[model samples]
Target: MCTEELATWRDVSLVLLAAEALLTGLPVALILGASLRRLSRLMVGMRTVLFQARMYVWRTGEVTRRAMGMVAAPFIQLQSTVHGLCRALDILGWR
Candidate 1:
């Protein structure tokens, strides 16, 4: 055999190992990339849930505005009633 022939079993094994790497490496790399993408999406969702949970723990619904809206409505209604009564009393000349 020529010296260029892979003369040793070690040389043949090395060539086979390289061929195996070339054949399978592309598929392994693709699988790893797909798994990384899925892991990234899962991490983002987990972060959002963690942030919302943190905000809730900080506020306990105290973040909601206290309602003072109803406080003035009843007084305005009382004033209107008094104005109507005064007008009726004047029309009758009863006061």
Candidate 2:
């Protein structure tokens, strides 16, 4: 082929290659943008779940402490009753 024809062919090839690159890159860019958006949403959801779990644990601890206090009340009352009986027996000369 003549040099002028070869140059024309090279120019055409370059233009076609650029067009193909743009066409291929557009979808890839869109897919990556969508993926990033989904990842952001997932991160936000994870943070919410973690915060809720932490609050649940904290509330559970508070409930457990209150339950223990309730369970100890009878024992405390029994001790007080026993102490009063001991004093009464001592006063009655039943040591």
Candidate 1 wrong stretches, greater than 4 Å: 7-13, 59-95
Q: Assess each prediction's global lDDT (C-alpha) against the native.
A: 0.84, 0.96
For model 2, give the 10-residue run with minimal summed lDDT.
65-74
Off by more than 4 A, model 2: 53-95
Per-residue lDDT of 1-95 in model 1, one digit per residue for the tens? Answer: 66657568669899999999988998999999999999999999899899999999768655443233366667878999999999999999999
Location of the lowest summed lDDT over 10 successive residues in candidate 1: 61-70
- Shift in Å, residue 49, candidate 2: 0.5
Candidate 2 residue-wise lDDT, 1-95, digit = tens: 69999999999999999999999999999999999999999999899899999999999999998998899878989999999999999999898
Model 1 error, position 90 (Å):
84
lDDT of 2: 0.96
